[model samples]
Target: MSNKTNYSYVGMAFIILVFGIIFVPRIVDRIKNQDITRNDRMSQGQDNNFKDNSKLIFLEINGEAKKVPDFSFTDQNGKTITNKDYLGKVYVVEFFFTTCPSICPKMNKNLVDIQDAFKGNTEFGVASFSINPAHDTTEVLKEYESQHGITNPNWHLLTGKKEDIYKLSNEGFNLYTAQDDEVEGGFEHSGNFALIDKNGFIRSRVLNGNPVIYYNGIISEAEKTDEDGQEEQISMLKEDIKKLLNE
Candidate 1:
């Protein structure tokens, strides 16, 4: 071959080799990273798709996993209550007064749905404790229960001593519960539903406030559903309840 031709051939080979060296590793690294990312996504999808079967793992209260103190109160039928009564059932506990003309109605409706959802499920129950013991007597709670058609055995509308309910709200659940004497009632409570495991330990605290309202109305008041509405809150609450039940 001529010298010029030979030089041309060698230069072409050198250029090809240099190009391969620069681009091949980058292409291979990109493929590897893409594979890793895909695998990570699949792993996460599988984790989300799988249903967890464990039941009622208690969350820490006051920095420790401890069973709440047991106490006695009266149900709407005037029966006494204690931790032993719910020893083998997962109970949902909420604090409210009958005269609450705001969030209580929505809260009660949600509880009713929950009760209906677990109608035959003996492992679950609902307890609505009166923060205004003086006003929320057994008779008053009975009337309230009747108003809502609460027929499920697992659901109880309870009224008790003011101090007892206050302690349960504040100390047992590690939540804020107080009386608003200025508001013409001895109680003004927050909207929270606590999931109490069979062992009397709290598993989750579901806030009953509807973020969409951000005011007096909760899920029930907004008849016309907005872009961001109560369904989201209800769905989250149901998922949390399921998780707690299957902990």
Candidate 2:
């Protein structure tokens, strides 16, 4: 009986060693190649398919999808640019001034972060229209861009007629912008970023089955919310931007 028990132990050890020798290396190789899956996330092939089926909605007006109006402006490099220039790019539009010392800083900081996320993608761009164009001339905007570490070649710090800027803000985009002496900043504008698709139509994520319209740019996603209890939507904006890019 003792001899039989010893033989059984030896057989079990041999079987275990054989299994390790035959399969352990292949298991390790699969892990090294990241070929293992835990049944939680989508597979690599489904990622693009997921983006294509996103629930992003376009802002509609008068039973038609609203499109960004035409406007011409000069960029920080003193080059002529128009809405047509952004036809094939997924872009974010914002109204701001170089001299703004309040929310504009926070808004642009978030935008710079977004630019960093898609560093090499020419399909992405930003249109920063200066509400204080008279003061935010090409030189001033160029200086501001440098000061803020703006490095994206596609980002256009635009300045044109102040009225045209205001018209685009108030009527075209419906994002408020005006000169207000009562405000901390001499000029007041929305601390919001408008996402546009490659076709120049405004795009947004659905909230309560309706378009969210604009993303709050004043708060950082890190903080979640501000001192005044305003929650940040920059994170959602980034996701929706990716969705639009995919579309």
Candidate 3:
């Protein structure tokens, strides 16, 4: 071959190599970013669908979604509190009596942690219903709140008629609560905490006709290791709250 032709061939090969080095990585990175974005979109869509399809049923309504029953009670500060007061807000619901020496304290501590986690967010609140209204009057609940250092304005300790409280606990929240003379605390109540949506529907319990299951707080069995049980519940509760808030 002529020297000029050999030089031309070498120059062409060098130019092709330079172009490949400059553009190949950019092309690959562009494709990678596109894949990442598409995967993210698909993941988000699945998340939305999961949230939308997961329905919390009010057990009293034949496994249908229904609003929580209206209730009127007095808070620790002598203020009349009712379901109307928490309209348009997400809240955690629990059943307890002030004098109980069993799981009530642990449940309250967990609730305290939850309260601190969402502090200053007006969209969230906590409500504790006294199972023994006769003894857990507004003044008694006030003392209990003070003893526990519960200073959150959004946390309300409620006291009302015993019948009303029991009905609300059993029929409304779908929890077990009764005056059991045989029990240590003179009352039998579930330790589970319930998450209620802004629209007043119990969002933490699922009804499957056989029985309703609560999502968080104390459970009959730990789904994970004992050490991680409460932690996992808190984490799941936090995620569920975020989902409801976003929805």
- The lDDT leader among the candidates is 2
| Poorly placed runs, candidate 3 (over 4 Å) | 1-64, 204-213, 219-224, 227-232
**Candidate 3 versus the native: TM-score?**
0.68
Worst 10 residues of 2 by lDDT: 40-49
Q: What tens-digit string does per-residue lDDT give for candidate 3 at 1-247?
A: 8999999999999999997555544433332234322112211111111122354433233334557789999999999999988888888888999999887887787777777777788888888999998898888998999888676787899998989998998777556788989879899787666777888876542222112234445422233324432323555566667767766
Tens digits of per-residue lDDT for model 2 on 1-247? Answer: 6999999999999999897555544433332233212221111111111123455665555345679999999999999999999999999999999878888888899999999988999999999999998899999999999999799988999999989999998888777788988878788777778889999998755443233566777778788767856566777777887888877
Error of 3 at 15 (Å): 55
CA displacement after TM-score superposition, residue 40 of candidate 3 (Å) = 38
After superposition, candidate 2 runs with Cα above 4 Å error: 1-53
* Local distance difference test, candidate 3: 0.67
Clashes of 1: 3
Q: Could you tell which candidate, 1 or 3, scores higher by lDDT? A: 3
Which 10 residues in a row give candidate 3 its minimum summed lDDT?
A: 41-50
Structure candidate 3, residue pairs in collision: none
Cα misplacement distance, residue 140 of candidate 1 (Å): 1.3
